[model samples]
Target chain A: MLRAAGDWTTASIGDAERAIANVVRQARGVKQLNIAGLGQLDTNGAMLLLETAELAGEGQAVALTGVRDEHRRLLEVIAAASVRHTDAPDDGNPVLRVLAEVGETALKLAREGVELLSFSGAATMAIVGLALRPWRIRWRGLVTQLQATGLNALPIVGLLNFLIGVVLAYQSANQLSKFGAELLTVDSVGVGVLRELGVLITAIIVAGRSGSAFTAQIGSMRVNQEIDAMQTIGLDPIEVLCAPRIMALMITLPLLVFFADVMAILGGAVASMFALDITLTQFAKQLQAAVSINHFWVGIVKAPVMAVMIATIGCFHGLKVSSNAASVGQRTTQSVVQSVFFVIAVDAIFSIFFLIIDV
Target chain B: MTSDIPASTHPLAIHVRGLRTQFGSHVVHDDLELAVRRGEVLGIVGGSGTGKSVLLRTIIGLNRPAAGEIEVLGHLTGTGGAAAAKAIRRRWGVLFQDGALFSSLTVAENVEAPLREHSNLSPRLRREVAELKVALVGLPPDANDKYPAELSGGMRKRAGIARALALDPDILFLDEPTAGLDPIGASNFDLLIADLQKSLGLTVVMITHDLDSLYAICDRVAVLIDKKTRIDTIPELMKINHPWIQEYFGGPRGRAAIASAERAGAAV
Candidate 1:
């Protein structure tokens, strides 16, 4: 027999748990719980008492003696409400868990690949349909997206490429001067900036900025049931929302890349004037001789493809959002990651193609 | 052993005096005063934009009043030191409308959060307590492992109630507990609240617009009027001769609720 005294309520349970545990340990296999001395009893306290009885009685319900009229019902209720203990889900082996995680991740990636393919197909169909009937297109939304994704992105893209060009010119001029070829810095800066760095950097920046924005905007709309409302109203969300954003990005990205190329070469000229004591005319002459127009076109050609990849990735993840704010946050993060990853991968592919074809 | 701990000498669970709440140039409450008795369900009702939630938020120290003396469980809310405030806070639980369960946690983990934060109970014990709380709130056993997003509207509110009751608090504050529930679900929730209050001997302060809930479970109703409050029993409040009060209880919906409650009372 064990004496259950003192307040069993939440107000005192924090202090009483240790004492109760001690008693339960000492009273192992005890079959009777005496509660005549019990103070105020609430749900927490009753739960504690019931747990104590079960523990003391070796996982069996124990009888209560001296149960007062007031406390009897509470004790009975709590006992009936005791949660049936179930084994926690088997996390058993660390090595197996890690293997499972790897498999899950690979599966998720494959599923994402398939999803992206289907999304691209649908978007292409929408674009082709719109192209066939230009009057059916939403010109206002396309123009707005153009202004947002393109015009608004100009300053940052231009400034970043310009800075990259300055750094490239300074660093290359220093390296080339070691070989008594300081004039060749213009070639490295022009070819490298135009063919790779300028477009690559612009794509990355746009992926982080506009790509993430697309995901968050559309994902939140999905969460708010705005997408469902549009569908119910006989409007296709893909045609109405995704198509405009994609077209705008496709139109803007090349312009942005071209603008970036010009700004970077101009920056290289400025840097050459400072670093190599060469005038703008001399630098421009060297650039004209060093880089073919094909290098600029090579970079420009990658922009539209990268834009489609980024915008489609963004819109795909956005449309995948389930009905919650947390999913919106998660899908937005995924959109950014996938877009940036694809952008770099496509850039690598373009580089390889150019290499094979001897551009 | 627990009897030696210091108890609040005051009879009231909450006491507010001269509470002045405002947002910039707009005044919400002016010198509003309220006192909630121990072990009673007090319902706060008001018209739209009448600052009912603001008042509840102020009493719980979420909103800082422009000027007031707000005491909850004998501790001055904002004026008290952190330790004192936290102590008082632990003694009460507030359930916001829309369940507001942490989307990240499963239902059981959501209930265990307060226990984890405030108590030194063992992990097994905490889980047991959480499970019991969930069961007590009438949630299904499977709901313990399910995330809040998976639960339906009514189930989400029940999960919220389970979290609120996890601490076995002396006072429970519910903000529109039955707002979005269907009529049957709302009344069932009211009955569940009334049952919990009776069993736990809790002091409940509820903010609601549901006249049926007010009629069904409220011990007394506090009507927010003219930027202040008029506190009285429902029948007494009905006799106040004020226009808003008259229109409120005498309104068609209110009359229907009263009639339904009368029928329920007669059946009982």
Candidate 2:
């Protein structure tokens, strides 16, 4: 195979085929005909080769060469694979066509992934620059965002956690009654609230809410070249931009998680009071007794880790934003998905580490 | 001592020598040398992507130059991360091509952006400074309360200029100051610049393609070519036989220059 150079110009298949036919006609005694230096082929070249080869009456043959990667891939597109029969023009393999389309789709996906990776790399460089200078926080921006992310997120987090506890208490009671182990329901409610639901729900919420918001905010800045402006004004975009968000989330998320856990347990207590006629005093005692410090800390630790992951991933995606409206959506969605995925992955890693340590 | 000016005349506003900025394989500026005196207007005219913006950006540390020495307002040239540039930012102001005022803020708040960022001045002071600029630019008092979206094209451009002038900078850089404005509005901006230069002793550097603008107010002009300052002096530009420059100031654009010269001759 002859390698196509950068300046290679594509020829139509018909033209190449005509050239091939002329070459074949000229060289009457040659056994094997190889065409090279045509560089890359379009359909006009490919089809001409197929047709001319099919029509070789006596002792002439030609094999097409010098197909570039893209040319070969396009030929694999089923249009010029050469027909099975001259009798039926319509009876080409349908599966091959479908497979070609699938291949093209896969290529598109690969291209998009590469594009995203490059963008992420650019932002990573900018963030690294900011990280080198730690004291560049825009305090007002930080305060405003913190109030929005933390103080404003409180009521929803509180109510959601409280209700989650109620569900856990009621559900555990339902299963326990069959085995006459209703007391175990208290342990289940306590464990679930303190050790799992609280952290998971808060992470999901933060991932959904704050993650997208960060992406939008930074994405808009990214689009506006405000991030570039920051750089120009002797400010590290990441330190003035990313570090604050990351720090705020780290500080706030744990508190939110702790609140969510307490509220969920309270929810469970309320359900216990209604279902089992257990007094708030008795419910509180059972919750405290059933939940070990280990269990509480397990979920509590996940909060800060999850928070860091969320804020970092969100800011990372935001900084990756391109100079348009579409990249804003793309980065915001990517940020949310990536943050949630990272939070879950980190949570699992921590859970296993804790288990390995016998914590 | 240069032949154009006496030995005692020192250009205090900006002194740039051998400024070269390259991005990857593209050299945006190469060996660009320019000096604009205090209380002078230097209009830089170049087509799009010719490093007009890059030159202004490099001087103020918005874009990093690969090799150069730029002294603006008695400070060394620093790139996007230059601390010296930050310290000198209050003394220099820039009006972007698109105004580029923060969309979230009202006109008054937008004008106060630099002041608010760099100063510990109270709200009242910021407000007073904002009001002064607004009035100086001839924007109505009510224009301050309106968002950027509420303003027309000329209004936005004026607001942007007002913001640039908020700190009463020693050197002001404007990128396409009157681009997309009506003829009358453009002339109005030019007259305003002339008035400001006279009253404030302000040194102005404007990047524009408008011939009327250059003739109307600019004390001198620098022409950029191939992303570099091809001709630093206007007479040197006349002697140079570059196609675009000749076409720009000779073929069609020469009419304006000839007319302006005739007007000067008639006045004499």
Candidate 3:
């Protein structure tokens, strides 16, 4: 016989559990729990006692002696509840499970790729249709988005490019100074900033900043049922939401890239003045001689393409958000990552094309 | 657990005196006083902007009243030390309007969270207790593995109740527990609450607009009027002369709820 006596409420369950553990270990052949001395009983205590009885009886049902009416009811409820089956513990081979996960992830990526392509096509068609019918375009949304995605982004973009320009010039000067060819630092900084780094860095920053913002904005709207409301009201979410953002990004990206080029070159000039004993006038002259307008144009040409990829991917993921708050966060993160990957891939393709064409 | 504490010796579960709550110059509640007895379900009802939720929030220490003395389970809430407040919080559980389950954790893990934080129970035992609580709340066995997003509204609320009962709390606070559920689901929820309260011997404070729930489960109704509380039984409250109180319990929906409650009583 096991006599359980204590306030078995949550407050004292910790101590009671310790004491019960000792009793259950010793009562190997016990078949009865006498709870007549049990003071206060709750679900937690009832569960603990039920477990104790099971462990003591070694998987057999242990009968209780002197159970009160209320304790009887409580124990019956807990006993029935304790019999529920939860998820089975995983005993599968780790290797096979990992392989399965890898394959599932790959399939998910491929499906997402196809969906994103279709969404891009739909958005492109909408933008083209709106461009042709200029009067039907939402000028207010365009202006608002342009200010939000462009004007607000200028300072961060400018500051980062300028800092990158300084770092590049300093690194180049360090290399060129070994051979007393420090004058060529101007050539390297001007050409690198105008041809590759300027637009690449700008596109990456915009992808992280505006791209994630687009996804989060649209994703939350999806979560809130605002997208469904818009559709029910006969408004095309693509036209009203996606088009303005894509159009504004397309218009601002090239201008931002141009701004980035100017800021980075200015930064390179300042670094050269400090590191290479070169004056601003000489730096300007060398930059003019080394970097041509086509290098600047090469960088500018990738801007609108990157903008389209980034904005479309962001909006696509946003539209794909399921009706939950977590989905909004997950989609937003995916949008930023995909947009950055595509920006670098498209930039590589542009570089190869430019190399083959010798432009 | 404290040596100085007298466990369950107090007659009142919650005591509030001179509670004055304001947002800027707009007063939501002023000089509000209330006392809740132990082991009783009290329903708080009010019209829009009458501070039903505000009073609950203030009492729970979510929103501190501008001036008030709020005591819950014999502990002075919001004015106590961190350890004291935590002890008080452990003795009670709150269910928000929505389940407010952590979106990242599954239902089983959501139920285990408090145990993981507060108890020294083994991992297996904690899991068992969480599953038992889930079962106790009438959620399916499979729901233990599912996320809150995957569950229906009613199921999510059930999961919320399971989490609230995770510690076998002395008091359960529910805010708008059946607001969005269908009529049948709401009645079932009322029954579930009534059953849990009886079995667990919990003191329940519920803020609800459901007259049926008030009529069916609440032992006493606390009506929020003129920024103060008028506490009475439903039948006694119905006989009061306040216009809002009259329109509330004597209204069509209120009458229907009372009629249904009477029928249920008759059947029982």
**Tens digits of per-residue lDDT for model 3, B1-268:** 4323357588999999999999999999989999999999999999999999778778766667899898887878775566566567667777876676665469998788777655778999999999999999999899999998899999988998898888778889898999999999999999999999999999999999999999999999999999999999988887889999999989899889889989999999
Per-residue accuracy of model 1 over A124-243 as CA lDDT, tens digit each: 999999999898687877998899899999999999999999999999998999999999999999999989998999999999989998898888777754564343222467987899
Per-residue lDDT tens digits for candidate 2, residues A1-359, read 11222222243442344555676565445333344444555565555544444454344444445554666665566354666565656746899989988999999769866765665465456546556755545566678778878888999889888888888888888888899887777789888777788999888898898988988998887786566544533456666677678777878899899889888887887898898888889877876786788899888988987887788778877887887999999889988988888788887898789889988
lDDT of 2 by residue, B135-213 (tens): 9988999999999879998888888889888877777888888889888898898888889878888899999988878
Measured against the native two-chain assembly using Cα atoms, what DockQ does each of the candidate structures obtain, in the order listed? 0.01, 0.20, 0.01
Which residue pairs of candidate 3 clash? none
- Give the TM-score (vs. native) of candidate 2: 0.69
Off by over 4 Å in 2: A1-140, A154-178, A227-244, A266-283, A320-322, B1-9, B73-75, B79-83, B104-106, B116-123, B145-150, B232-239, B250-268
Worst lDDT run of 10 residues, candidate 2 chain B, spans B1-10
Cα lDDT of candidate 1 equals 0.87
lDDT head-to-head 2 vs 3, winner: 3
Task: Categorize the docking of model 1.
Answer: incorrect
**Alpha-carbon TM-score of each model against the true structure:** 0.54, 0.69, 0.58
Q: Which segments of candidate 3 are over 4 A away from where they belong?
A: A15-19, A66-70, A84-96, B1-268
Q: In candidate 1, residue B60 scores what lDDT? A: 73
Give the i-RMS of model 2 in Å: 2.8
Q: What overall lDDT, based on C-alpha atoms, would model 2 receive against the true structure?
A: 0.75
